[model samples]
Target: LQQVQPQGEDVISGNVSLPKVNVRGVVSNLLRQRETKQGPERVGQTDSDVINLVSMLFDFILDDDNLPVPVKALLGRLQIPYLKLAIQDYSFFSRGGHPARKLLNELARAGIGLNEDADHLKKDMVFKKIQSTAQRILTEYEKEAVLFDELLHDFSQFMQTEVRRSQMIEQRTKAAEEGKAKAQLAEKTALETVRQRLDGKTVPEVVVRLLTDGWMGVLKLVFLKYGPESNNWLGAVKTIDHLLLSVAPTEDDAARKKLFNIVPILLKNLRQGLNSVSFNPF
Candidate 1:
């Protein structure tokens, strides 16, 4: 700190000097990030200080009584898993390809009236992602009461399983195209031959493999946590039902047929999960 005794004019205003510290590696990483328009090459699932800082700001905003009613209502339903992921997985938020990041950008655009900082804030990639998620929660599901975290939890698990399965199928097909058809068929036949004499770790691996598509994967998302023991099975079940039923039969033929084939499996899984609390019912 650089300081001097108060002069006559300063004495009247009670002026004082304070030390200033520059933020570079810790936070100004973002300022440089904006200037360069590129995020760091690698990212992981943890950034304690950034996560804590964002959390503190969220709490501060949420607790501010002076905020308008709509702002409060918007923040209330904005809880989602990826909000934290956006902080933890820096590339996902900053590299400009993620939908979650787009959601944040949307929020930046929404902040025009309440604070003057909003105008400048929209340019920061990280800030935009955080804000856009809050905005989407408010606008997208205004008619319903939903916790964004729970929604992400239910959806991400199912989507991850499906996406992973599709990736595996594509890999297998590519291998076969590269002249590995015999190997692929052999592997499948070997697994089939051992169907009755399954090993300990085999069931889970196979379950994951089989649950790669619409029929089984959808079942897991719907009733796995929607049992009677769950806190809000009704709401979770309702959300799943709405998502599934909204797709019209004429719109997508393949999806419609898949949805139809899924109903029976979904019912069986639902009965096993919610009723018996057993992972196996079929």
Candidate 2:
């Protein structure tokens, strides 16, 4: 392995070097600038002026081209710890030559030196006021959160209820459609029997008996199942009314009267057969 050295003019070229005249020129220029700005008669300056002059010198050294080589080498070899110690020493000298006592005195004037109740009352009152204001704001916010939560909960419940209602309506509609389908099937069976009889084809005796008696039997079933209340009995009464309309004599009195007579007598005989459970002759 080989080590590569820096070859740039800024780092390796000896011609780009620091010189003694640059240091002297920078220091002298800083001193003259300070005197011109702050007045000529001030000789033994304060600690703040000394610090300013030192900072100005640091900037000038950084900018000068002909700085001293020894100074540049020393700055390059400086460690962070050594630089920090130098800064602390400078700061100690700046703070009235005694940083600890100056800091303590400032803290003391700011109420650190007070005994017992000397400052407690005012401090406690201010702290308590701040606490009370914070508590009031928290309570108001909590109440608002609770109100918002309640509103959200109510809306959720209302939506659920609407969903349930819609489902129930759908179920009822499906049940009604199924019931209509059953009734249509029963009507078709009855019509087929009637068609067979009119066409002079032999119908099973059981089917004829059922068609004649089943309408009255349905009326009786309705009455027995729902007779406890007047509203419940309304369906039975309606069935009886429709039965009378279907069998009643009409404007073709002669023909309709003959039909009414034949159907009623057939119904009387079928009623007896339907009353007997063991009379199935199909």
Candidate 3:
């Protein structure tokens, strides 16, 4: 067997000739773009800007580049409602900590495996539980009245696998790096590895997470669009926390306390006036 070396910016593989590549130029251009567009635009408080932001968020979710085919199809039934939810509060989707994007990205990234699991997973009891619960949440949202604790209870149950994954990551990190500094670096790498590898090994976990997270994203976008003036979703969410606190003397459910861990659920409706502009007119 004969091995061929690079021949003056060209490579020979049998009859095939590989072209020379400019790696540095590719990377430099990417960096330049990132420097210019690393964050969401600084949207103004103007009525128009609010409307524009809401419209943009709606488009972002449905655009071809934003979602993969299978995942999009799976949630297609809810897209219109989801967009309606977002326009009500665009601020929430813009932030992190919501599990919806993670679930969407995971399912989208799963490729053919997700489509294969669809029928089987939906048939699972856990999947049915999630579907029923999510539908209930949507109904409440439409009525403009949401039970904060109920949502969290469903969320906690659905996130059990994710919680276990977190614990596994922590245990693995602590096992390898007993020291603080090394532990941080190791945990970071481990998390990236875990996220990249995650997929629906079980039908129930996948369906539940997908429905829960998708709705969570929709619910969040509602606040981002409509609750900008309140400027404190946590404060709104804390009303529930305060109520639970008042009842803690007899409630006795320790897990209910975690409802305080939620981001605020603003009661304010989406701002009106579609003619308004969110971007700078000048």
Candidate 4:
């Protein structure tokens, strides 16, 4: 079998243009040349209809905009082979489950969403696979139809693995986005809590800086780990209130005694909170 070289064509603005020629005449000439060597065979009305239908199918495949230009070109190489198949087997038209028909469908589907401007066309896995498949059929196929089934099975497995990998990447991206949103909310809640407590209260510059910068981070961390209603969150908030009261000017004897009593515990709690966030007290 002489390898049918792909006809010349040009692609412009995502459309392909082939030299004007009669498709039926081309098919007839190809069959005539083959018959010359293999002995003359009568061309009947059914063979003519099959040739015309295969030509139309090729025309549709070429004109399809969804397929990339390179993909369309690769598929065009199969025209002569497909024409021969359809003429020999009438079931190529009637049987939708034909291996050759399914292989064609899989090739087109695989090429969908591939960018036309991709660099190094030969390096692309899908394009390479399609190119290899078309070349194998062109050079190796004679009367064996099982070749189509073998190619289809291998291609389907590759595509299935690719689909699973893409799904996993997509899921990880979604999870990262959700985690970012949750952290942002937690930070906002932490800021508002600190601001409300310090509002209308005269506190030392050191205390103000500590709560806004270091303690606020601790609150955000606690909120993220144990939620707003957790005992850990309530205890952290209470520590902030006690720290403020300890800094206030108190002349009452009872109040001063109480402040002194709680001062050691307040310092201990503050040290632990700051350490949780890796904040240095010094």
TM-score of 3: 0.28
lDDT of 4 at 272: 96
Residue 117, model 4, lDDT: 60
Between the candidate structures 1 and 4, which one is better when assessed by TM-score? 4
Ranking by TM-score: 4, 3, 2, 1
- What is the Cα-based TM-score of model 1? 0.21
Question: lDDT by residue for model 3 over 121-143, one digit each (tens)?
Answer: 44544334434443444445442
Report how far off residue 64 is in candidate 1 (Å).
8.7
Q: Output the lDDT of residue 31, model 1.
A: 37
54, model 2: CA deviation in Å?
Answer: 57
The segments of candidate 2 whose C-alpha lies over 4 angstroms from its true place after superposition are 1-143, 201-269, 272-282
Model 1 Cα lDDT, one tens digit per residue, 175-195: 768545544543453343234
Model 3, 145: alpha-carbon shift in Å? Answer: 6.7
Candidate number achieving the greatest lDDT relative to the actual structure: 4
lDDT of each: 0.42, 0.39, 0.38, 0.80
- lDDT for 21 (candidate 4): 37
Candidate 2 structure quality by residue, lDDT tens digits, 118-211: 2342343322232232223223322132332343344345446655876898999999998677556545544553444335434455454544
Candidate 3 segments exceeding 4 Å error: 1-71, 93-113, 124-130, 143-149, 161-282
TM-score of 4: 0.78
Question: Local error of candidate 1 at 45, Å?
Answer: 9.8
Ranking by lDDT: 4, 1, 2, 3
